[model samples]
Target: MFDSFVFMAPPLPDDLVTRYFRHCLEDSLFTLRRQVRMARMSGRFGANDETRLSLMPMILQSLLEDGIRDRLPLQRVDPEWSPETLVIAMHLYSVEARRIQSPEETRRIQQTFPDIKTPDFTSAEHTGQLREAYIAARLAALRDGTTPTSLSIGIEL
Candidate 1:
């Protein structure tokens, strides 16, 4: 069942895909939701890797198109906002999401990449709250005249 949902990228409308990303972020199932997010951004999957392509990248790409058409909030906050910035944010969120959802896998990942910093999601009660905090922090930094780096919204929250 989980495999079906993760592997099949239906021909969902752009709006629906965007909505699905939000739902996935809020989903309680760690194995599916967090894994999909992490896998999508892990850079191991090529553009043609449909079996590995999860919903996060699809929706994020769609969001970038929408942002180009209708100016995303990050754009208003910082005129230099690009899709790469959003992708980086997604990657950070995925790292934290995987940590919160799958501790064992996260530990293995940490051991694999010793220098990589992972967020402390041990106490988080909701993934959405953490995502909101990240976005809020980025926006705050941008509004304060600080050039919001890809990691300006660190995993502090």
Candidate 2:
């Protein structure tokens, strides 16, 4: 259910961002329980640990800004909200980028993902897996021919 794309994010570093992604993937309880386990084991839970990080930005943005909540499951999938995840959310918004408030926003996305290839992304599927589905569908939607059915309301203008 994680990193199901051809260009899946490369191995992350030893930082909290990477560790938290690992931790959140283990459990469906929003955050991983093992982090606290390892924290207690290692001592101090290590503020330096990314597992103690926050995804509040994605959560709020997904809810307030994007209005695409079938989006990601913070509790079920993972909640590291790493730059990669943030980018995913941005691209997901790209799926319907045309519908948001500004042309500037749409142009920004073009700038953000200039290399967003088509055929590679257009076929992304859900595989009946939530996380996998989220990633695939979002990527697919970013393809050149992809204009979410909702596009009529925005860029088609």
Candidate 3:
């Protein structure tokens, strides 16, 4: 069932993709803030979450409007892609864009979250890896009878 959706979905328009990216960025920040607030209530808010909270605004600011339209590779939002896939791709692109637009902020983020991976949009290999990872995650989510949430994208606070 999910495989059929993956195989038959049409490519999303460039404008729609850009809109999705913007929505994802806003949604991610809102979700993170709520999580951080809850964690604070529980005395579970930690250094890593603090670091992410601080850096997320910078990254989000850099990727707004023209920044997103200019940085995003529309081609990578494949015809087989779901909204979840676009969320993952946009998240990766956001990281790469931040790295290019604000190296210092990117460095701060990397220092805090050493395991977070960003793709080199110029490299086919890197983009291919991203595509493969998205497919695997989507398939796994389907098999588990769950939908992938945009918040699961690694950069979430």
Query: Which candidate wins on lDDT?
Result: 3
The parts of candidate 3 lying over 4 Å away from their true place are 1-12, 55-157
**CA shift at 5, candidate 1, in angstroms?**
18
Predicted candidate 3 versus true structure: per-residue lDDT over 1-157, tens digit per residue: 9656554533433453344334434444455445655787799877655544443333334343234444455544457756655565567566656454365643432232223334312333333233323223322332332212455444554
Off by over 4 Å in 2: 1-26, 50-52, 56-123, 127-129, 132-157
lDDT of 3: 0.43
Candidate 1 per-residue lDDT over residues 124-152, each given as its tens digit: 22233333332333233223322223443
RMSD over all Cα atoms, model 1: 17.1
Best by TM-score: 3
From the highest lDDT down, the ranking of the candidates is 3, 1, 2
Query: What residue pairs clash in candidate 1, if any at all?
Result: none
* lDDT score of residue 41 within candidate 1: 60
Displacement of residue 125 (Cα, Å) in model 1 is 6.5
Which stretches of model 1 miss by more than 4 angstroms? 1-125, 147-157
Model 2, position 2: C-alpha lDDT score: 55
| Angstrom error at residue 126, model 2 | 2.0
Is candidate 1 or 3 superior in TM-score? 3
Rank order (by TM-score, best first)? 3, 2, 1
List, residue by residue over 52-111, the lDDT tens digit for candidate 2: 133333343453434444444444235555666565554544454334334564333223
